[model samples]
Target: MKKEIAAVVFFLKRLIKKAEKLEAEKVDLFVERLTVALQEKFRGHWYTDNPSKGQAFRCIRVNRFHKEDAELLRACVESGVQYTDLGLPKELTLWVDPGQVCCRYGERNLAFTVASFSSDDSDDKEDVTKKVTSAVERVTSDYHSGSSSDEDNGCREPRYITGFSHRPPYQQSLLCHRMAGHVPVFCGDRGDSRRHVVLAQ
Candidate 1:
């Protein structure tokens, strides 16, 4: 689980480096420092999908408009790096789109949503991963399940995901990107049914 999280962070940092075209040594230094900042202060709110609204992606949201961005910026300043040059935006969101397992971290809010997939009540004993499992089922079923009335109605079903299981998805740590190197902003709003696959906390 730690390896999966690390892989995701590494992938995002690499994209930032390439986009900014930083020197190799500088990339290493900045990424290292930024990683520390993230580990220390990157608070994420995990959200499940809203399939009823035709939304099919699950995401972990970090509102950069809040104090988290400031901590990250302070980390950059201490490391003698400019934050804007890194091209991170006012919001950082990580999403698991349909048919993909790994997360896509982005600079913009996917869109405003009002789906109540989660409970704010304190009596809820389920962990975040349990709450997120149905969404993963929808994702994985997209491959095996044929076209349904849902698709005909212009609604996309959520697809497969990994690293969320009590059973390991793979014996070895394999880094796979569903989309090739492009940081895309998919405009849509989407959840899970059927079998539940719980994610590690």
Candidate 2:
């Protein structure tokens, strides 16, 4: 009976050691797989396909080390704008605007403008007037559309205006017609000017 008990204890110890070795090997293999996958997925055009160059893509920022979900955190940071796990099992999703979409990891302070067009119309006097009027109406409507019609409720509609100066003579000619009165124009220092009629309120 003593011999049998000793044999059982030795066998259990060996089994536990083997299990631990296998678990370690499995973890190593998983990390290798994850690294390869991340390299293939998040690899950008900025980096040439030379491993010796040791290039990291510009979009990813590594914050700190995490032992629990190290592989997952690495993958998320490499692919996403920002990621936070906070001791959770999975990473959290972050919101980004259109201007923030194409920025590098450390370029969060950058600002950009995005303008939309209605149709294939040209930027003539009529088009400019329509756009200016539309902008003003939209702003006013958004502010006062849902207000109650009470005389005592002092609500004011918003206005839109643009100023122009120091432009080329020919460019200024295109802005105001000789027969028409003073027309508001959207002038860019680098590009052509757009002319519009400012509606008198």
For all candidates in order, the CA lDDT equals: 0.38, 0.30
Give the RMSD in angstroms, all C-alphas superposed, for model 2: 26.5
Write the residue-wise lDDT of candidate 1 on 82-118 in tens digits.
6666544323444332222243223311232111222
Pairs of residues clashing in candidate 2:
none
Model 2 poorest ten-residue lDDT run: 99-108
Q: Roughly what TM-score does model 1 have, to 2 decimal places?
A: 0.35
lDDT of 2 by residue, 94-136 (tens): 1112111111111112222112222343425454344334433
lDDT of 1 at 189: 18
Counted clashes in each candidate structure: 15, 0
Give the winner by TM-score: 1
Stretches of model 1 off by over 4 angstroms after superposition: 41-68, 89-91, 95-201
For lDDT, the strongest prediction is 1
